[model samples]
Target chain A: MTPKMNSVGVIGLGSMGYGVATSCIAAGLETYGSDIRPEVCARLIAEGAADASTSPAAFAGRLDAVILLVVSAAQCEEALFGEDGLAPKLRPGVPVVISATIAPADSRRLGARLAGMGLPMLDAPVSGGSIKAGKGQLTVMAAGAPETFDAVAPLLDAMAEKVYRTGTQIGDGAMVKTVHQLLAGVHIAVAAEAMALAARAGIPLELMYDVVTHSAGNSWMFADRMQHVLDGDYTPRSAVDIFVKDLGLVNATGDSLSFPLPLARKAYELFAKASEQGFGKLDDSAVIMNYVGSELPGTRDN
Target chain B: MTPKMNSVGVIGLGSMGYGVATSCIAAGLETYGSDIRPEVCARLIAEGAADASTSPAAFAGRLDAVILLVVSAAQCEEALFGEDGLAPKLRPGVPVVISATIAPADSRRLGARLAGMGLPMLDAPVSGGSIKAGKGQLTVMAAGAPETFDAVAPLLDAMAEKVYRTGTQIGDGAMVKTVHQLLAGVHIAVAAEAMALAARAGIPLELMYDVVTHSAGNSWMFADRMQHVLDGDYTPRSAVDIFVKDLGLVNATGDSLSFPLPLARKAYELFAKASEQGFGKLDDSAVIMNYVGSELPGTRDN
Candidate 1:
């Protein structure tokens, strides 16, 4: 008989992880949340998540599944294998659902390491922003052995609207997710580039956004990100640094395969430039600032 | 009093022009069609356009409006002022609607030249594609004097679903259209780049298409064009050379403004390369072949 995923431990209560934890709690799971920030932990508990201890090991063998939603693969590695990490405390064969966007090679290596220690690793990297995570509508591009998926099926159902079982190989989910980021990163870069050109060319930025969202040039990222640019609101829902890291992973993968990815590489450089200009912590759409710095285009009004 | 657009001449019956001509006829206007190609002219007549002579002078004085849907600014100028052109034959204040994608500077120059001939030039470049043109649902980014727009109102209504009267400046329509092309060209190029990356990364091409169309990575061009790439069909709905010219116009405008558009320029180079590889006449999505030419990425599949 398949085991039920009745209790869950969510690590890294950042924007995305907090939503995941809340959704799990809303679904009646005994959800626990932990972050390096104590306030974040307090906030999640206020939102109905079970109380979490400062040390990740507190939930150890109690978790039926662990959702790792940290910033990067390095953070994910530290959470699982670093001092006071959950690896030594969890029961053997409990599945770890990895949700960060990381390089496929790193995911494979981590999967191997975890498997060697009798843990089943589910390579699941999610798409959709935090908003979707809150609504339990995020798309999870996931892969692992059929039995491991069976073990965490209840948790997957609670957190995702569309779960693409990409392949059985633990690395395949990360592979597809990386490819998805290549497009997402490029779309945001092109959105900034195209919108700045329009603004400089004497079209109102708002008009450009309205026309484009209705035209063939429209993209999900363009529609979503450019709205933030149009609103002049750079409150970081997804920061520029996120693309910095994601596109960096893209470039590294292309390099490993000897593939030439000029556009994605160009997008990466733009995000890096924006990050350097001190817009790293702002919304990802603030990459537009790299093009229209210190003033909105087409006018000296600023 | 606003005069009805009783008779109109549509020059250059290409994919887009043919649609514009048929749509004009469908709107009950006496539409005359002309093309360098005899067969295209014949087809338009069969589609209910009025008969045409080899010379554009056939309906010159009879036309209340002339829709110039030719290839470029040069073609637009030639159709109006070239040998046996319609310039000398047109009466003063007859509005000529220019619907080709060209630089704003060129539009101003043409507007000035036509104004010298007593014609009220309406700088109108349309969006949506051939299908929308045929359905009379194109979006026209237009600019001219209010009186000229009033004079050409009937014709504009016949040809477009959305008519954005940008301003009274003759160059304004072309400016907005140029900006629109910047997005459209970059979107197509990036769509090819992203889809090709996914194809090479071991994701089945069709599955990648499905996941992306439903994901945040989706773009109108990606959803529309990648279908051609996936079907292995290169039947040109829109050719690569089209982007070559459009992006060249984008490059020229950016240069004139001293603005940096590295990504648009990069996309232009890829389309140019694809054209050089004998895919110029193929569909624009053939740009994907540039990446996956020698092999698909992971397995020795394709």
Candidate 2:
């Protein structure tokens, strides 16, 4: 079936955004890419994006839908309503699908602001790292008005393998995503903790990894991230600071609700410490260094 | 080819133990059962065990191998060395495979004690819970001398679907199990923390569960234990104090090595608090009560 939205604009062409833009191109959508990095925009254009427009406003009016894949809610706001904001140039009723991991409250506020301008907003936060994003196999936890979801179904389909309609309330997607990040962040931290203890006890990290992946102890993060620990490669498929940021959002939401999330708080602290120790730019699995000190399993120091 | 060992003695017939005993019987072994509870011992006999002796000494000499599925290290030592102890009555070279979760140090100590009596021991802690145990599909993380493992191969094959030889060291299995518990315990607690946050935000617990199970946030424990949260069924499939004990073991190991496991420690505290608040006998998912208070998702209070 031909998708209704034939042309798409994807802002913030970082690792995730770049993948989304390329996937849209692969899905036969005329994709426009924007990023703070002009070189990345150029690279996306070379990779089959129809245009590498650094200014979203330049082609915003022609786009059928816009996807915001920036890092933070503030950036989501700035990109859409800032000095060179694209929302102002877009035609009314053009659905804006925000796939950034933002707070539900922020998402609700953004949806309200866009509604005031006659635009529809769907809070569609995504999971699965850039690898899946590049494969167009991301899982999108989305919530918005039914028509808004229908409007962006094709764009969502282009970038995601599974798109869950959380509810018609815009913030439901963000709330689910926040809870998801809570699990993802804690699982990574606990995987690191488990591995460090295994390493300290003189069990081979590879054997521990094999046993865990096959056992009830396994998690998607444990299977995926612990490989980096085994290989001693910290190339930052997802960096430490990302969880530091995401778990911080989790805690912020908990705080706003006067609810306590101790595990999330602890995981956030672990990531924050990893960031503080100069491992922030390293892979999230490098959080093991917080427990193992300088002697990582596959590293030269060991 | 027939297994090297044909007759087996299984001690402790609680949920996990009863399943293991039945699985051994199903494998065509002459399984003997021993439990403090006379009724459970009789029950195992009804399920085709060759004998159900309350006193291990009564059958220890005839068994080709013995499997201990008791609760703790002290109980393990008591079962083998206390009045009516089985070790003294067993023939030399009768491998004793201990499937109870215990500290590595305790396992090593038991290995030393058993070696003094010409008894070989395998530290073989199990996972997959009671259901898998009944299906004979549990994962066994075992460590012992190669000869000892070979001696009990048939019995291990009968009880476990996957048997990982962690190493030749007696304590290695315990270490791996401890590490596994570190992951499992933390995952359950974090699952509770995440679900609580979702419930607090008014997201349907069922939808959050579905989204997580399908996303990167998924873990074996979250998928298994959170169902209790959704059903509001606090039935003790695995109780809160089990993690209180397991994560306590995790932290004790951490303390011994001078390693810090902040996530495990936080999860342990959550479980301990749950236990303290009278949820200890409930399923481990009841840890969510620590976060959501009395208003659990499917409970009448909600």
**Residue B60's lDDT in candidate 2:** 80
Off by over 4 Å in 2: A1-4, B1-4
For model 1, residues A18-61, the per-residue Cα lDDT tens digits are 88998898889999988999988988888887777567776687
* Cα misplacement distance, residue A116 of candidate 2 (Å): 2.1
Complex DockQ per candidate? 0.73, 0.88
**Candidate 2 CAPRI grade:** high
lDDT of 1 at A117: 91
Tens digit of per-residue lDDT, candidate 2, span A1-302 = 22478899999888899889889999999999899888998899899988887787778888999999999999999999999998889987899999999988899999999999999998999998888889899999999988888888889889999988899998999999999999999999999999888888899888999999988899999999999988899999999999998998898899999999888888898999989989999999998888888777688544
In model 1, residue pairs whose N, Cα or C atoms come closer than 3 Å (at least 3 residues apart or on different chains), thus clashing, are none
- In candidate 2, position A209 carries an lDDT of 93
Q: Give the TM-score of candidate 1.
A: 0.97
Residue A2 CA displacement from its true place in model 1, Å? 4.1
TM-score for chain B of all predictions: 0.95, 0.97
Q: Please, what are the lDDT tens digits per residue for candidate 2 over residues B101-201?
A: 99888999999999999889999999999999998999999999888988998888898999999999999999999999999999998898888888889
